[model samples]
Target: MPSTIRRRVPNALLDGSRPTAPSHIDGSATRRMAIVLVTLLGLTHSNPAVAQIEGFTEPHATIDLAATENGVVASILVKEGETVSKGQLLATLDTDVLETTLEVARAQMHSTGKIDAAQADWRSWQSKLDKLRELRTKGHASQTELERAEADCAIAKARLEMAREDQAISALDYKRIEAQLERRRIRSPIDGIVLKVFKDAGEAILPTSPNVLTLVELDPLRARFSVPTPQAASLRPGSSVLVRFPETGRQAIGAVEFVSPVTDAKSGTVPVAVVLPNEHGKYRSGVRCVLEVPPPAGAGGSTSENSANRATAPQKTDGPPGPNRKDNHV
Candidate 1:
């Protein structure tokens, strides 16, 4: 048997003057609090860091092309802003004289009548020499007669050799004239856009004349920038970076191609270069751009030092200087 269990109830519960909060209400509050805490913790760890660096876009190559031969400009095949391929004729000098000379040389080189005549003469002499040798062996010809025949045969052979030599020289002269003509025809040495045409048709061009045209190579454009020594140290050839052109609103991925070994003592920075592909001529150079590179892992430094790095970082604002080393240009 159980003894009578009695519990005292609150006056409010008995009269139900006001409803108390339910047990489930407390459970709901605890769950909502847990969700809020988890969200706050995630927000703290989910933020990503970004590093901004300054840079500029430049042409892969800039060449001032000059004529190799001196003559009057007969024609200009390309105009400013026109794209051209390597070895494409851009202009031509007067090559009438060279052409005429080449024709004459070709006529001489191909002329075989003289050579045939020489061959006939040589065969005749050889036959005569052989006959003379046979007659001398049979005691029908004197030694002096055989010697005279041999001399004549040798002279004929020399004449034939001279004819061949003349033909070879004529062929060589024709090639020389052709090479000279080619030099007079100014051609683009690289695939690029003509920035300016310095000479036009009917103008005179000289071997020592100033550049005939200014060409800029666009493919594989270069982005040159400077970064703090520490940041630059982490950059290696083949490293990729994001390049953003502020003027054109274009963005591209570029790869590091150069890291200068020398550092600027005053700025404590090093020069760096990245090559960006523009095979389709989609990108133009000489524009201000920014490079976005994430900080290296485990990179920790003073705040002021980092700020200085950002402040003193080199930004490309002008056209890049001409390439110095052979490998520097694309």
Candidate 2:
């Protein structure tokens, strides 16, 4: 038979008293753990993570329309907020004087009287010279006479050339006046809408006058953003981005049009521009927006794989380790 062995219980246990509490080191460690967990929870609740960057929308182009020449405004063709096509007539200056001048120039350019008269004169001189040559050859005219006739013919030829030059100058002057007349008619240089009309009919336009009107292109609006340098590195021309308008709750996919190569020293950011198509004139510019950046390559695959592994993993129990379990001694 095996010998019977006996173990003595503590005095506190025999008296029904609780054992001494855990050491201060263990208690302090537990408090520290609780503090860390509370801090993490508070941070998570107070500040939510933001995945998008803020930006603003602006027109692709804004033009101040003005006349190249000075005159009085005769007519305003388009009013404010009117859509205009490229090369459409917008306004006109006083053209009464210019029109009359252009008409006179046209007549001068079309007339051939001077040219015909010069030709006739040249022919008459040539005929006389021919006769003089013939007379000299037959010994019927003196050498001096022949020489004098030759000089006269040359003078007539010079006059004819001068007349031709005068006619050409008149033609050029005609074209110049016609161009001046056309300049008086202001035309749209771009497909856009007139935002303002600064001049009205009968208003005098001087060389230093302000713009006659303001035009802005609404189609293909531009979105501008200031992004951190680290994030800007991933952007390039033609890259796609998700843009959102918070005010209207509208979203669009825009293509990156520009990315500044140099970082801003003061802001520690880089300027970025994206293009959003508004072909139907549905979108207005100067609105606030947000830009969503895409994750790096292969990040989505890794995250999905991790989630699947977690789902298939075995669950752990909170109880003590079993007899077969091996504890790791750190």
Winning model by TM-score: 1
Task: Provide the RMSD of all predictions against the true structure, rounded to 1 decimal.
Answer: 20.5, 23.6
**How much lDDT does each candidate structure score?**
0.66, 0.66
**lDDT string, candidate 1, 1-330, tens digits:** 111112222232244344322233334433333332222222212212334457677888999988876778899899899999999989888888889999999999999987899999999999999998999999999999999999999999999999999999999999999899988888888989999989888888765675788999988799888766666766788765555676765555567789999988877777888887675666678776666544454544433344332111112211112221111111
Mind sharing the TM-score for model 1? 0.74
> What is candidate 2's CA lDDT for residue 139?
97
lDDT score of model 1? 0.66
Task: State each candidate's clash count.
Answer: 0, 0
Give the poorly placed runs of model 1, Cα more than 4 Å off.
Answer: 1-50, 300-330
Question: Could you tell me every candidate's TM-score relative to the true structure?
Answer: 0.74, 0.73
